[model samples]
Target: MKIAFYGSSLVSSYWNGAATYYRGLLRDLAARGHDVTFYEPDAFDRQQHRDIEPPDWARSVVYPATEEGLARVLAEARHADAVVKASGVGVFDTELLEGVIRNGASHAIRIFWDVDAAATLDEMRGQPDHPLRATLKQLDLVFTYGGGDPVVEAYRGFGARRCVPIYNALDPATHHPVAPEPRFSADLSFLGNRLPDREARVEEFFLRPAASLPDRSFLIGGNGWQWKELPANVRHLGHVGTAEHNAFNCTPLAVLNVARDSMADIGFSPATRVFEAAGAAACLITDAWEGIELFLKPDEEVLVARDGQDVAEHLRALTPARANEIGEAALARVLAEHTYTLRGAQVDAILAEEVGQMRSVA
Candidate 1:
């Protein structure tokens, strides 16, 4: 199958958390014998801070952030078997969504891959005339990163023909245990962009915990955190790249996963960090969220914390041997059920079924 995907940057993790998710899924699709071309807007300063070159597995096209560029990409998309326009493309998203749905109406299978399902759904619920809501019925299929049942049902209510979650999964080849790096070595580490939705959670779950344990070292790796005042024990390493994730994960005695408010309320949405940290054999401590056990068992495979006190207590009680056991268990669980290979196969089956159903109707 020939697939065309337009989303946030694929080669840079700078301010774009979806980079890992896109790289993992699209690389697996290409590996499974599909011709996949990724179309990313050249805005967002992603190219300026690129962490990786385009991979050989799939074609990566960066288009200008202009009307002319959208025209060219829409033309290119029309020829593919399936054309997907993902949320958070950083520019002209509504225009891009409409263009893909309009141009791919007859030939290509049109898909809206919402990486931030909770936020998208929230917007749609609050605004009656959200552009995406106007075109919900036109999409052939919808895919989400997380938000299991509630998200699916919400999309259905908005007239999405079909909605499925292609949850975040680990790419073992990209994220695995590595020798610990002295630079990133810390008692606790967290890697996430400081966004409005997630900043408060980071404060509650990561910064507060670090403050309570002043003697312990805590490291943060991501962009947009320079202005915030942090605890003395917490060190900030702005903009950790994709290549550094494995080492970053391995260097920490334990890694923290703090979901944004929208994701936490919706439940069942495990961010990509959870899988990446687990894949690197990092002892995981995460904020309480619904459906986390569906990914990793709490207290056994992962440690769950409701507040700063919980995180501090967990950190204080963690022994080297116990941390290793938890990390190993989490790693085993992700490798078994949360690898990109399995996700690729699921995507293949879903598309095939959709195609078959289309044929039957014809």
Candidate 2:
């Protein structure tokens, strides 16, 4: 299969989370012998701030963000077996969708892969400014990064012919436990990009835990949180990337996960870090989110803590023997059910199903 992906950025993970998810999924697809041509805008300076590249497995087409460039690219869209458009790209998304929907109908399948489901829904509900609502009917298929329940209903409710959740997945080969390094050693670690909405959750679910465990060393590794004044007990390591992520996950006694407001409200949708941390065989303690148990069995594969006190309790409970067991179980569960390879297959199935339904109707 030949697939074309037009997303926020496939080349950079700098302030771009969707890129990380796409790289994992598409790279897996490429490994499966599918030809992938990832389209990225020349804007955002992604080439300079590249995180994960084409991986020598796929082709990358970086085009200008102007009208002329988009028009030229849309012309080539007809050659692809599947073409994907992701949310959060700072362009004229509605117009771009309209073009693909109308012109790319000859040979390509149009897919809208939404990384931000809640924010998209919220926008669609409010005003005409939401670019996707009108274009939803024209999209061949809809895939979400992580909304287990609400995502399906909401996308279909918005007139998506088909909707599927392509949740964040872990590749165990990339995220395995390693020898503890001094840089990553901490009693607990939380790694996430800083955002306004997520900050409060961090304070509630993360910082408070640090405050409670004065004796314990907590680490924070992510971009954008540096300006925010961290508590004395908490150590901020700024931004860490793919090479350093395993160290950050494995060295800590326990890793923390706090969902953004949208993800927390939507439920069941976990960030990429959850899978990464679990895959690293870290004793994982996530802030109570509705859908965690569906993936990681609370008290079994991992633990869930709501308040600072709960974090403290889990910190104490996770001894070497206990923590290792939890990490191993969580890793097993993620590899068994939550790899990007599985997600790619799921997407392929959905696309095939849609094609069959169309043929039957015709």
Candidate 3:
């Protein structure tokens, strides 16, 4: 099958959190003998700070961030078996949603891959006439980044024909245990962009813990954190590239996973960091969220924390032997169940089923 995927950025993880997910899924799709073409807007300064080169597995097309560019991409998409437009394209999202439905209605299997399902649903609820809500029924399938039951129910409530949750998974080839880097070595490390939705959680889960453990070293690797004042014990490394994620994770004694407000409320939505850290064999400590056990068992595969005190206690009690055991357990779990190869097979099944249903109707 020939597939055209429109996402925010595939070549850079600068401010885009979906880069790893896209790379893994698309690469696996190509490996499965499906032709895949990725269309990404050339805005967002991603090209300026590109961390990875375009892979040969799939065709990567960078288009102008303009109407003409959209028209060209839409034309190409109409010729494909399936065309997917993800949320957070960072440019003319509503226009892209409406245009894809309008232009590819007959030729292509339209899909809205919502990387941020909770946030998208929140917006749809607030704005009844949001483009996604208006075009819900037009899409052949809706795929999400791990929103469990509530997210699927919400999309179904919005009249979507079919909804599937494609949770984030690790790409063992990309993320694995690497030698620690002195620059990123710390007792605890977190890598996430400073977005409005995540700032408060980062403060409560990360900063507060850092403050409580003044003697312990905490490192942060992300962009947009320079404006905020960090504690003395917490070191900030701005804009760590995707290639450095393994080293960053392995350098930390334990890594933290703090979900955004909507993700926390919706449950089961594990961010890319959770999988990456685990893949790098780092002891994982995460805030409480529903459906977490679906991915990793708490206190066995990972440590669950409710507040700063909980995080601090875990950090304090962690021994080298115990931390190694937890890290190994988490890595084993992710490698077995949460890799892109498995996710690609799931996607292949879903798309094949959709095509079969279409043929039956025809």
Candidate 4:
């Protein structure tokens, strides 16, 4: 199948969190003999900070962030067997969402893949005329980043024909165990681009914990934290590229996963960092959220913290041997049950079935 995906940057993880999700899922689909062309707009200095080149697995098209540029891409999308308009393209999103369906081949399966379903749903609730609300009914299927039953029901309520949660999974080839590097060495570390929904949580879950444990080394790696004051024991490394993520994960005593306000509240939504940390065999300490057990068992495969105090306590009680045990157990579970190979197969089957049904109707 030839699939055209309109999404955030695949070549850059700069300010875009969905980069790995696009690479892992689309790379797997390509490995299964499907052709994928990922269309990303050149915006927010992402092109200037690309972590990867155009990969062999998928054709990467970087278009100018202009109406003319969008038109050219829409023309190219018409030939795909499946046209996916992912949420949060960061430029002309409504045009792409409606354009893929309007310009695509009649036989092509139109999909709206939401990388942030929780936030999108919130927007729709606040605004009755949300563009996606009308587009939902026209889309053949809605694929969420990862919000189990609640997201499915919400999209269905908004008039989606079908909705599925494609949870984040490890791309073992891209992310795995690596030798620890001294530069990233820390008692606990968190890597995520600083954003509004995440700022308060990062303060409570990461910064607060760092302050409580004055003796422990802490690190923050991501963009937009240049001016924020930090505790004496904490280090801020601005914008660690994707190439260094494994080292960042491996060198920390235990990596932290702090969900955005919406994702934590929505539950069942695991960010790409969760799997990336697990794949690198890093003991993970995630802020408390519902449905965590569905991915990694709390207190065994991962450490769950209800607040900064819990995080501090976990750190105080953690031993090197215990961290290794949790890391290995988490790695084993993800390798067996949550790799992209399995996810790709699931999506492949769904595409085939959906296409076959379209053909039958014709």
The residue ranges of model 2 lying beyond 4 angstroms of the native Cα positions read 360-362
For all predictions, the C-alpha RMSD in Å is 0.9, 1.9, 0.9, 0.7
Give stretches of model 3 more than 4 Å off: 105-107
Best by lDDT: 4
- TM-score per prediction, in order, is 0.99, 0.94, 0.98, 0.99
Stretches of candidate 1 above 4 Å error? none
TM-score of 4: 0.99
Whole-structure CA lDDT of model 2? 0.81
- Local error of candidate 3 at residue 240 (angstroms): 0.8
**What's the lDDT of the predicted structure labeled candidate 1?**
0.92
Candidate 2 C-alpha error for residue 343, in Å: 1.6
Residue 239 lDDT (model 2): 63
In candidate 4, position 41 carries an lDDT of 94
**Number of residue pairs clashing in candidate 3, backbone atoms closer than 3 angstroms, sequence gap of 3 or more or interchain:** 0
lDDT of each: 0.92, 0.81, 0.92, 0.94
Q: Please provide, for model 2 over 150-244, each residue's C-alpha lDDT reduced to its tens digit, 9 standing for 90 to 100.
A: 88998888888878888998876677888889988888899988988798988977788788878888999878788988889898887676777
Kindly give the number of clashing pairs for every candidate: 0, 0, 0, 0
Pairs of residues clashing in candidate 1 = none
Candidate 4 lDDT tens digits, 1-362: 99999999999998999999888999999999999999999999999999999999899999999999999999998899999999998899999998998998988999999999999999999999999997888899899999899999998998999999999999999899999999999999999988999999999999999998999999999988878988999899999988999999999899999999999999999899999999999999999999999899998999999999999999999999999999999999999999999989989999999998998898
